[model samples]
Target: MDSIYHTLRKSNPASARILVRKVLEKNNGNVSKTARILGISRATVRRARDGELNDLSRRPKNIRKKMDCFLEKLIAEEAKSTGYRYRLLSYYLKNKYSIECHPPC
Candidate 1:
């Protein structure tokens, strides 16, 4: 019952085509009923039936921060023992190893 629309993947032409085909079969080749039941536009269902879906590979575009294994393990141990994190963890790292983990900026 949510009105919000969330697009996790921007492009999914191949899946769209497959879905239209299955729904079409279920609805006995009725495009209008298929689109209505699937909550999609009739044009979309028509395009899918017209073989407009392409097989494109979708890949993640997110970047992750790199952390040293030793430093990460040490941080985990310190957090588990003292429950210090973020700014406090930065303070401990700086005071113990003389390295600035998180700058004020």
Candidate 2:
């Protein structure tokens, strides 16, 4: 329907695609079946279901790397100021940095 298209157009395309996939799954993957239920064309349903969906949820890898570096620097600075136990520092690094300090495995 025009209203459905308008409503979905207001949303992020990736989210709209995900919603279309859910509808298709609920209808057992039958495009015509889903289209009939959704009141949209089979082609539109298929496009929404099989379109090159963008993952807006993921941060860029470089951003993640920068965050890790920043956290590491913060941990080192805090350790210098607090002079906390090595175990505490190691725990902070492990939990926050996701870096393994002890190689048991």
Candidate 3:
């Protein structure tokens, strides 16, 4: 079976970082849980989360730009809605918008 790292190696590094953050948040910021899910070391996940891992597979800059535009639109819409805090807004952005902003949790 292919390891999770091997599988993710083919994806955009930015997307991978976003995925790692999402997983960590979903698991309540548990490094061990994120590592188990990714089939990597807890240290590796910690490094990536801290932006210390530089071997990221970058996507085309244009693609990233497009994603950022879409995320901005979504955030604006959500921010206008009632009873939405920044933490919840960030969480919604990750889960629903697929945007990788730091949740206020």
Candidate 4:
């Protein structure tokens, strides 16, 4: 028989996952043997067996807001009153309103 690793190398990742599933079945569901035969990790064999071949999302669930709503509103009001741009407005807020102004984290 041809080397099992050769079968995996000849196919793309999707097809390789499918092949891993088939090989796993042929190996009587032995994850270690399946991984050794296919030249892949045991985790990868388990994922393929469980139909989890797709990539997972990397995005974080909770995004941090750049600034607080109250602070933003206060800045907008100050800007309208003084007609000052952001850099100067930051200084104005610091000096006049006693609010520390810096770039949002």
Candidate 5:
């Protein structure tokens, strides 16, 4: 029991959660009992039981470039020649080349 406490304390959060969940399973999923044994909250025990301890990515799935290669090169040339910043370049591209350039979504 003291060894278990020391092991959990020394391990990373994910590993600790895994250990707790294994113990919870061994105790037949008694939330309060597991929480009490681990000296953690019942909500923490429940969350660990439900496998919600792992980190989730916040990145978007459908990420893509707003502009293509040719348009990118054109913008570079225009920027080199006119020294225009993003907002000005966007306006210039829209009005002059009929390109719908805007900031990334």
Candidate 6:
């Protein structure tokens, strides 16, 4: 049976890399043997050995926001002119513009 690393994914890169290093040491730095044990490719084991172990962000660079920029600007403008807090701004947006807004915490 393969090790848990074969099925497990999106693991913390730093921790994974550390584990890879320890396993490599135990196997006397054999990349092929280490890869088989970890259930990963030899290249992957090599990458971990080469020290590229930082966790990559799961969040995408271009995220779709619930409130678009235009609406956010409008809310900001209203808040600035009216000197109203987020609660009041939220209320005004709901009642006057018929738009639902949850003020950012």
Which is the winner by lDDT between candidate 5 and candidate 6? Answer: 6
What order do you get sorting by TM-score, best first? 5, 4, 6, 3, 2, 1
Residue pairs in collision within model 4: none
**Residue-level error in angstroms, candidate 2, position 74:** 56
lDDT of each: 0.70, 0.70, 0.74, 0.79, 0.78, 0.81
Error of model 4, residue 3, in angstroms = 10
Segments of candidate 1 deviating more than 4 angstroms: 1-11, 55-105
RMSD for each model, in Å, please? 9.1, 11.5, 19.4, 6.4, 4.9, 9.3
TM-scores for every predicted model: 0.41, 0.44, 0.44, 0.49, 0.55, 0.45
Q: Give the Å shift of residue 82 in candidate 2.
A: 78
Which candidate comes out best when scored by TM-score?
5
Deviation from native of the Cα of residue 91 in model 2, angstroms: 77
List, residue by residue over 1-105, the lDDT tens digit for candidate 2: 364544775777677677778889988898998777667788988888777776445755565324467665876786898685577777766887676554223
- Stretches of model 3 off by over 4 angstroms after superposition: 52-105
How far residue 92's Cα lies from its native spot in candidate 6, in Å, is 44
- Per-residue alpha-carbon lDDT of model 5 for 1-105, expressed as tens digits? 454534764666577788788889989988888888887778877777786565567788775765678888999999899899888888988889998888544
Best by lDDT: 6
Clashing pairs in 2: none
Lowest-sum lDDT 10-residue window in model 4: 1-10
Clashing pairs in 6: none
* Model 6: how far residue 60 lies from native, Å: 12
Model 2 lDDT, residue 12, Cα = 71
User: Residue 80 CA error for candidate 2 (Å)?
Assistant: 70
Give me the displacement of residue 79 in model 1, in angstroms.
67
Give the clashing pairs for model 5: none
Kindly indicate the candidate among 4 and 6 with the higher lDDT: 6
**Cα-based lDDT at residue 26, candidate 6:** 100
